[model samples]
Target: MLTHFERSLVEALRPLPDHRLTAIVEVARLSPPERREVFDKFGNAGYPILYQEHFANLRDIGPWLFCSGKYTSLQGQYNFHHGLSKATGDTPISWLTSALEPSRLARHLGEAATASGPDGSTHLLRFYNEQAFPILHSRQDLPGIDHLLVPIHSWWLRDAELDRDDGEKGWRRYEGKDRADCCGVPPIHLDQACWDALTGDGSSQRLADLLGSLPGAPAIESYYPNWLAQVRSLLAKGRRLGLKQQADLDEFVLFLSLHANPLRGSAKLEAAFNAAFKDAVDGNQPLAQALKQRLPPRLLTSQSNV
Candidate 1:
């Protein structure tokens, strides 16, 4: 269950203000210790502080702070895979355990090397089934998250091609140029294009549909589905309280994080709640106040109405 500190953090997050919520993005851009300090106050005894950033707009890069201390190695092993599994689906192709398998990396390394781009950066082409592919986005260290050392990778760049738009007639233009001059090239800002190809303007619902079919495939854990379901259920409840978007998960989690302590509500749900909120509630004072107001009054459940 949740220790006192985790419980405290949750309370602080429950009634998040929009201004403070935006402040979260700013705080996320802070120094590691400073950022973690925000969540350190709310986590239960075991609660770990964590920050996550998306790369190639495809994967969530996390610098997680759990009780034992930060471990970049574990994060590296899970980085791209974790984000994809959560956003897409957890299947054998995107399986966490499978990715961690030493053999998997060894087998893929040769292919990873051959696929290097002109910039000397190698592409990680993950083959799921036979027709789909994944690619790497970019590399940068985000401190407020984990002291993470993992590079972000995405799965959709395998088929991406850039077509040069009509070039302005000039010395820079090579000879006679028409739209034909436009040909296959990948953008330096691969992340944005990958995002559009996957979730935005030219987004493929077919891909989303494919990912949906993968949840219970071989090697996928039974619990993940239940976990996701529970998250959606709580999220739906939070929507009734005015949380309607993906960001609402933060406010909902903040609420639970506050009452997560024994002093506020059910230890079971509080424990469960802390697992979900983690780094999202950065122990800011506004969050602390919100919990004081939004937490439900503690009551015994006798199934009294029934």
Candidate 2:
């Protein structure tokens, strides 16, 4: 029953890990009726196999999600922008129908009633029997699929914005509006820089350039000591922060240690930080002294202060 493309996709996905392959298989096996059930319930309007391919490709190569243009509708509009905005809202009566029906609603209402305490039982039962069950029973069966595909929508890519012309026509459309009067400022509306970076031609190449520059440009070695110095300076000034701030700083340090150095793991970084703090507190040395002792000497020596 598989088409050539579908067969090829399955072959391609076969070599992936068991979990990924299972996901692909589950998506691909969705019968037409099953897919229709999903569309009717969720307003998602894509072939399951297409979504499966998108997911598989995204897993293998990170940027495939953006490049696939699966986000684009048949009309060339962004699917989320055009399609999702047009989706009908569920009626209030549908809620009650779903509650009384032998569907996801009954389970949900039961959970809500339990969470609400003894007084909620009557109200919840009334809502379910009168509202949810009838609407749910009237509809066809829902999909058994584990995951739902939700498209990312943006206003910048809306048909109106993309169709804009320059000069005379554009000026006439804007007439009395100043730069401040508009929702967005200046010539190209929206965050032009970020928009171009995301949706522009050769977006994949731009992403590649970004990834390639990460390791060499910032020079992680240089960044680590400066971060440590800021923490040391704060400690030296006897300025205490709230628990959340302290936890955030601790997490930031762990992130820097894990990512900045290819050889280090969370456990190694944790040990280093633990040893440094122990030395600082027990020996009456400054936090900076403990850092210098535990961290790479080259990084500390080059930084001069902390």
Candidate 3:
């Protein structure tokens, strides 16, 4: 069944001029037959975001933009948008609408396919993924991001998952405005902020997944944003106090949440958390042991049982 979001989006784009609206889709999501129809057999139907000259190996699975006119046959807007939900498993989508010639828009995204981290590590950046694009669209930590957004008058993405937020999820339409011009080459550079939001030592989705999968972790259905924010906040606090190892950080987030936020609680638990952070970092004591040692068993038991 077509989702309310997809139906509404098709209506929104059906009136646009030829080449003005494009469906940003990942090739990996396309079935073999779908790939052949949209790409190999249908010339001018879509343009890939990864250039063959630079990313021949990745081109097959990279993101591609399917223009409206030829593929849809209904004016110049996409009528074939249902394929999107099929490919992305009905998750939110990233859309591109621009007056800049289709090829130019495709080239800009092709150039943005990779990124350079602040620490000097370089890797392919999937800037077009539905989950990642919303974060990319809002973050201004990198110049390359500006370059990518320059030609786009409107960028469409969603911040929340499809099933939970308001019926159609959180549809965010961003206008590219303010600050430096969007220019430059491939491999966008990233600072700490971008890295943290994008992939901070597996501290983004990976960390959330780790915690959310635990036997006692709260279900994300009703409190996705709160749960993520709480997890990140606790992880940051732990880092400040000296926790570094993955295991320690994970434990710290859990321990803090179990205490219903250690830093925000009574001065007693705060003191225990401080000692626990220090213990996890330098001393051989595990965070749980250190915290339990400092606090009474009744206190620990009450909170953990909650």
Candidate 4:
């Protein structure tokens, strides 16, 4: 059950402005401390209800599939960061299993496969399945994500209650004008900013300030201390917390809380770019060489940091 504080946080965190997508995209690309702060603030604790509902639905798909998205345009930003691409068939699943045995495979793929719509455009499907997941999960490794797909539909829905016959598909066959708003692009990492904003390099001071004034603020006051402490502990230890520990922790916060508008920012975009390039090069993944050629400066920057 959600505590009163959690409920309050959820209420405050909702209704994010679409323009914040630029800030989120910018921060998600940066490094640790920065990335962690971003995740903790925007993506983790401050995520909207649509995302929480979306993730809850994915749980029904079992441990292998993890779904995430937002109602706002931020979804588009996520798509760009994660590189919208498709990987049909078993190739994606096979790669996932091979990456780590099912037991070791802690990552779940988010699918947003959309179908073609009227006017030759695509209509984002309101629903998707395991088969469609792998195709879209290949992008945005910074969020420790695998793939994503947008399922499209032909019809639409204007309201929840429709006057349809019992034998036909419920609300699935509405005309173009009646079609409901279909699910669009799924956000790559919903919790990255929340995590960073909470625990990244210079975040503690801000968190402290927010905590003091959080009485009627978002849910940040409710779980900020405990959550921030745990993250700080992890960062202090700096042990092998896994490849994308910050991203994982951020996701955890979003999964557990119901904050309406905790915090959001775009301070880690460069770091995301760095991590993506490194993953491609060091891991020798599919797009490493090509990415290397495109972002030669990122490679040079990494070497300089060392």
Which candidate leads the pack in TM-score?
3
Q: The CA-based lDDT of model 1 is what? A: 0.26
Model 2, runs deviating above 4 Å: 1-259, 262-270, 277-287, 301-306
Candidate 2: deviation at residue 211, Å?
16
CA RMSD of all predictions: 24.9, 22.7, 8.4, 22.1
Per-residue lDDT of model 4, residues 221-249, tens digit only: 54454344433333322222233343333
Worst 10 residues of 3 by lDDT: 177-186
| Candidate 3 vs 4: which has more lDDT | 3
Residue 121, model 3: lDDT of 85
lDDT of every predicted structure (CA atoms): 0.26, 0.26, 0.61, 0.28
Across 1-306, the per-residue lDDT of candidate 3 in tens digits comes to: 646655555565556444266667777866676666666433456778888587888776777776654544444244455544444554335776666666667776788888888788887888876445655655544567766777776676654423443455655567764212344354588666556655644565565665566575557665455346445545555554566676677666666555554457688777776776677789677666776678776444322342
The C-alpha stretches of model 4 lying farther than 4 A from their native spots are: 1-146, 149-199, 208-215, 218-306
Candidate 1 regions with alpha-carbon error over 4 angstroms: 1-220, 244-248, 254-289, 292-306
Error of 1 at 283 (Å): 19
Worst 10 residues of 2 by lDDT: 146-155
